[model samples]
Target: MKIAFPATGTDLSCLLDGRFGRAPRFLVVDSETNSYQTIENDGNADASQGAGIQSAQAVIAAGATAVVSVHFGPKAFQVFEKAGIKTLQADIAPISDLMDKFRQGVLPRMQGPDKAGHAG
Candidate 1:
């Protein structure tokens, strides 16, 4: 399974960014190989109108089946739902620890967005 994490930095040791849409980048990890790649949020972190949508789109394009984040906004959650992507919630922690919790099935699966959409 490929999982994407909204990250504050480029590696597993880095802390979770806590905001899915505004994260600087995403760290996509391949479960089978334990290898990973970094996907820039493509300036979506600074987007005024559609950050969540664009970030979700980027994760989908990265072929991630799941996204682990502190929280998500409504529009982004809807996008992931429509794409058949699973959303997992994790507390603020290093990406590596979050992955460990995920492998242990301790991370909670989110049923809906934890946050409201950005207000224009």
Candidate 2:
């Protein structure tokens, strides 16, 4: 499976960036080969710009089956889910540690709509 993470830096030690739509980096990791690639955001806001959608598209284009991050706006979360990709929201920690936990099945599988989706 391929997983993408919103990252602050290039390496796995980076913290998860909360803004899915405008995260500086999307680290695409392939679980089989353990190879990865980083996709850069084309400079856009988290909510109302094309860049966010494009970034999510790029991750899907790279064959990502899942995304890990601290948070996502409702729109972005819907995009991923609609594309049949799962989203894992959790405490932002080191990417390597997070990946290790995932590989070990220790990290909980995340579900549900974005918090921003709550129509109060």
Candidate 3:
């Protein structure tokens, strides 16, 4: 599966950006090939309107099947759900370390969709 992570910087050692739309860069990592690509955020402040939805759309456009981040806006979570992309709250560690944690099954799978009115 492929995953996208909103990162604070260009490297995998960077922390995950907490704000989806405002993230400096997005790391698109392919689990199968262990390759990655980075995309910069070009949208302006107006992008904050429906930021979650917009971020989710960007991730999908990057061909991500999962999202690994520190947090996700409620609306963004909904978009992930609709897209059938897995979302997980990231540990407070480097993005590369987090990826390793995921591979090791140390990170827990996110849960919420089962509840009525589930949001981030």
> 9-92, model 3: which lDDT tens digit per residue?
887788877656557778988876778899877672146366556777888889998888766766777888988998877756
Candidate 1 vs candidate 2, TM-score winner: 1
Worst 10 residues of 3 by lDDT: 111-120
Give lDDT tens digits, candidate 2, residues 1-120: 988988888987788777676787789988877778998774644435454567778888889998887766666666887898887776888888888877887665557645563221
Question: How big is the positional error of residue 10 in model 1, measured in Å on the Cα after superposition?
Answer: 1.1
Comparing 1 with 2 on lDDT, the higher-scoring candidate is 1
Which 10 successive residues of model 1 have the least lDDT summed? Answer: 111-120
- Best-first order by lDDT: 1, 2, 3
- lDDT per residue as tens, model 1, 1-120: 999999888889999998899988999998878799999986998998889999999999999999999899999999999999999998899999988888898888998998988877
Cα lDDT computed for each candidate against the true fold: 0.91, 0.75, 0.75
lDDT of 2 at 91: 84
Better of 2 and 3 by TM-score: 3
Model 1, position 7: C-alpha lDDT score:
88
**lDDT value for model 1:** 0.91
By summed lDDT, which 10 consecutive residues of candidate 2 come out lowest? 111-120
